[model samples]
Target: MTQQELQQLVEQISLEYFKRPFRHRVVINHRFKTTGGRYHLADHHLEFNPAFLTAELRTDLIGIVKHELTHYHLHLLHRGYRHQDRDFKVLLQQVGGSRFALDVGNRRPQAKKFHYICTNCGQQYHRVKRIDTRRYRCGVCSGILKITTKM
Candidate 1:
């Protein structure tokens, strides 16, 4: 969809879901890599990833829009707008917005590190703690496992 179309959709969703008008601009931001959308705290503008306009990502696009709208509306109303806040969570759930921004890439938790590889199948694994390669075999190929890296 075009930028104009995105703006209209945001406005429509804002009124429909939040019962408030989205007075600020909504723009398609190509620079946004991992995040689906972002709400600017200073300007109140919403920036959405253009990749989300594709047919396969339409649902994600809507969710991102709703998520950003939650921030916009709550911040405008001087309520709890942060993700951890109760009001934001309740409004987000009510609007059926995504609980967290969609990570386009594999966004494993930061605490996770130990990387394992299957010797037979060449399959990779990520873990939070080191696993015993001697005892464990590849679940798919039943081959000896090896530690590839630690991150």
Candidate 2:
């Protein structure tokens, strides 16, 4: 969906659910990861990840909108707006918003990948950091571990 459509949807959801207008801006942010949407406290703006715009993710998109809207409305009303607060939890549950944004397809870039193999069981291990084989043994059969290559 376009930015304009997102803005309209935010406004519509705000009015329909909160019975209040969304006077702030809503934009599509490509940099968002882990979270489908975010509510900016300083500017009272809403941001949504563009990855959830596909037709297959329409349900997720609405849930994300509701989740962020809960934050926005609660903050605007000077209520408990943080995720840990009771007001936030109650409203989120009432609105059926997603508790956690489902990881769509975004992945954090790994600096380096390490491949490890066990001598006995041949069990493989993939890690982002190098490990000393002597210090750590394979959990399968207490076998000696060796670093194979960078994957």
Candidate 3:
């Protein structure tokens, strides 16, 4: 969806769910990497991740909008607006807002990769988790293995 559509959606959700009018602006934030949306305290503006604008992610987008709106409305009312607050949790659950953003694809960071080599057969192996050098041996010749590098 476009930025204009996102703004309209936020306005509609605020009125429908929070029973309040959204006077601040809402924009699609292209730089958001891990978060679904953000509610700025200084400017009272709402920012949504542009990646969740697809048709398949429509429900997720609405959930994110509700989550941000929860923050927006709570903060404006001088109530507990933080995630750890009881009012925030109660209102979020009441509005059916999602706590965590959906990781649609392989967007999360990869684990550390370790490279191992054998002394006898010179066989190389790459693994995501670290392996014990004393317990683990090379598969080819059962030779002693040592970590070569970590990436």
Which is the leading candidate under lDDT? 3
TM-score of each: 0.69, 0.86, 0.76
Q: Model 2: how large is the Cα RMSD against the reference? A: 2.2
Q: Using lDDT, rank the candidates from best to worst.
A: 3, 2, 1
**Total backbone collisions for each predicted model:** 0, 0, 0
Off by over 4 Å in 3: 106-113, 117-145, 149-151
The weakest ten consecutive residues by lDDT in model 3 span 103-112
Angstrom error at residue 35, model 2 = 2.2
Better of 1 and 2 by TM-score: 2
For 1-151, candidate 3 gives per-residue lDDT tens digits of 8888888988999899999999989888777887899999999999988889999999999999999999999999999999999999999999999999998663666675999999999999988899999999989999999999988
Ranking by TM-score: 2, 3, 1
- Candidate 2 at 97: error in angstroms? 1.6
lDDT of 2 by residue, 1-151 (tens): 8999889988998899888898999888889877799889889998889999888998899899999999998998899999999999999998888888878869878765898999999999888999988899999999999889976
Which regions in candidate 2 have their CA more than 4 angstroms from the true location?
Answer: 108-112
Per-residue lDDT of candidate 1, residues 6-113 (tens digit): 999999999998888889998888887778888999999999888788888888889989999999999999999999999999999999999766667634457768
